[model samples]
Target chain A: MSFKPDHEIYRRRFSRNLGVGLCLVAFVMLGFFLTVEKVTRGNPLDALQGKPYVAAPVAP
Target chain B: MTDIQAQATPAEPGFGDFVQLLKPRVMSLVVFTALVGLMVAPVHLYPVAGFSAILFIALGAGASGALNMWWDADIDAVMRRTRNRPVPSGRIQPCEALGLGVALSGISVVMLALATNLMAAGLLAFTIFFYAVVYSMWLKRLTPQNIVIGGAAGAFPPMIGWVAATGSMSLEACLMFALIFMWTPPHFWALALFMKEDYSNAGVPMLTVTHGRRATRVHVLVYTLLLVPFAMALGWMSIGGPVYIAAAAVLNVWFVVGAVRIWRRDEVQAEADKYAVEKAFFRFSLVYLFAHFSALLVEAVLRAQVYGV
Candidate 1:
């Protein structure tokens, strides 16, 4: 198969691909941060370590 | 090869078109109001969890928007305002929009459950269902009171935000919900007054179409009058302060005055003046909601500073 010159379709497809890629990356980052925050702030890690999980103090 | 390429090539949609299907403008309102709801709650949310909660809420809102566009593509094609939307304009396929909406809806709801509490997630799920199925598919085409009931879907975000923070509901949250719920009818009716032809042509039964323009005008005034109490009541809540109350008092007076002007005008006066009052009211309605929420946010900050919550 022979390759043709770059077409308008390729350009549009590239934009879509790039956008989807960025969104996926953002989602992964958000998930990572959320997990970190959950483990650090709460007693999730303590429970994981077989310690009695003390509930974090919540505001009224 | 050239012929094959020619046959395959159509107006392929860009990234922005997909974004448009999400109704970014509506999502912006959802984000802002939800943020206010989260911030004003007495409970403290870890920064990351708070951010994730808002993001999932926004995504859920965006998913509903995509579903609305997919379902309403036919009517959207007829309406001047919505004619150029992604699905209607054929830039994006209807099925693609539907798939995106469904996927995003599921993802957002599940992710929200992980990031926040089940209560918030449940509310988010219900909001998406209400907007995509109940409001978009049923109420919109069936009745003139569509936006009235449909407005609840929009009003849910703030309450969901509060729930995400506190894992429960509160009077303050309900007050926030009521504020948007009451404001929606007047805000949309003001738009209906000017965009009367769009709804009628699209075969969507808006108040301006079923009832007369005069009736819509009256409804706008009536709803605006009703909205004032809810707006004022929020000021007395824990989230509220002197700042919110003063802002609410001034904004409500201005809003009611605008609604009254809209009510007093007839088609002749409206047409002669190019629907300036109606148009102005529509614009101000956006500011009205934003300012009210901003006032609540300011009050929340002040309370935090004074009492160290």
Candidate 2:
């Protein structure tokens, strides 16, 4: 089967961009958590004010 | 027609071309605002489901982006700012973008429904349609009010987030949507003010192009005034706290002042200044939304710690 020149070019570009994007995503995720730990004194979630933990009222 | 026949385009499609297809800049706003919506709502979902729902929301936003790119490739090619986007640059075919958009839209909406609720999924689907079809294909060329009405599509993410958690909408959630909706006109029109030539060249009916810069400036000032009260009301609703109220008050005062400055400036001064006032307001608008939402998060935290709302 003859390969179209444009198809090969598109495939190469797509793969390259996908690889770059994946690397950036990993870096951001890792950097974000690391920054959170360093800034929040090692309890990253602690820095976030979580939703209130309200228990259901008992039926009378 | 002549350009299409020349050498069949020899420039090698690069990695950046494909990345441009996703419209990363617009996607960031959707993700941030949606996350804020999810966080501030007075409801909860299981951690895994919540994560999945948000992921699907992001995909839906991406779908909208792809479709917008496919449809607007013609105008995008003409506009200097958009000329190098994936579709126009020949890195990706328009049909491929359309296929990706349709596939992602279906996946996102279905997954959201299963993970969250039907209502949230419905809203997400409508948002994608509104942006891709209503705004991009329909209103963009027909009316100067394009951004004003189309801004609703961008505004829906937060409300969808709130609905994802609560399975319904509330005054607080709607206000967040309204705040962004009203803010979009001035924010975009400001860019339009500076980039009027780009819109005119592309045959887009931006306010600055269709109605003239002076009229556009007045509209910016009017909308900025409207945004202030809506932003403050979020604070009053207990959706925010002292931090948010203070931030909104100060930001809004400065914002209005900026808009008024742009409005009152003489055309000669405005032309020389160009994007200065508008640019400041635009940059500040980014901080304004972030600060308001950050305040909400802070208020939520404080309430959790002290009053336990």
Candidate 3:
């Protein structure tokens, strides 16, 4: 539908909420990536590459 | 310019009203349960991937809420409790809500597939469809068994979270699903007992409106009794521990006592006291669901330290 002046506020509101939601998602993704990487001392993506973790060898 | 051309139109809504259309209240529950499901799963997700899974799942929840508002606008407009909601109040047009719902639904599903797996994405898509179309559009106005079957939409999130991490379904996932599904009738019907007039006035066929308060009370007690076993079973299963077991035991006793009290009261007593018993039960039901889920998280953490699962 074409925007009437009356519809402009809602349109802007919709656009604004969409931006906020997307930004929040991006922030979460970055936070998780950085924090988890720091905790594990390596890139988390490395785990998904068929190697989640390596175990130390058993003592003889 | 014509006289009409000279006039300035007032703004229809602010940013907050659009957020309301997405039902932030319900979305919070969805996000929390979905997060728990992801966290407690055996397969560990890269934290960013996990975040993406939750984000899309939340958007999917929001999408369903918007669509429900769009479809239920007619009933909502007449109900005293919902009369001022965004769609019903005319702050946002129904078509706008629909457009937003559809767009979010597609975006969430596609993004989830990219972030996780086809199973999780598919489950999310089905959940949105179930809530918006199957439940809101069909079951709601049609049956008192509405929430009974329709509760599946809400129940899917934790399962979706589980699937997001594990890429498969298991008994644990189904148990989580069952907990919400069974808990819904008592939760909503308690609200219905107090808000029967709202549903009646809106022509919605809620149990309290159709079956009378007496039958509704019995239904509440029966459902709570049934729900107790399942709630406790979650504690018995792998996802739970002593913390959960104790919480479920106490919550169930508290819930059953409240349900029993409601069952004993008649309409005369209810009106005189303004549905105090029923209202208390409804309030407790919120805590019941939240606490049970929170306890599961606690148990998961404890087991991680002890059993290393």
Candidate 2 DockQ, CA atoms: 0.12
Winner on lDDT between 2 and 3 is 3
User: Which candidate number would show the highest TM-score if scored against the true structure?
Assistant: 1
DockQ of each: 0.55, 0.12, 0.19
Candidate 3: residue B86 lDDT (0-100)? 92
| Better candidate number, 1 or 3, judged by lDDT | 1
* Model 1: how far residue A48 lies from native, Å: 16
- Using DockQ as the measure, which candidate wins? 1
Pick the lDDT winner: 1
lDDT of 3 by residue, B198-290 (tens): 999998999988888889999999999999988999887878879999999999999999999999999999999999999999999999999
Would you give me the overall lDDT of model 1? Answer: 0.93
Clashing pairs in model 3?
Answer: none
lDDT of 1 by residue, B46-89 (tens): 88899999999999999999999999999999999999999999
**Cand. 2 TM to true fold:** 0.82
Query: Lowest summed-lDDT stretch of 10 residues in model 1 chain B?
Result: B1-10
DockQ of 3: 0.19
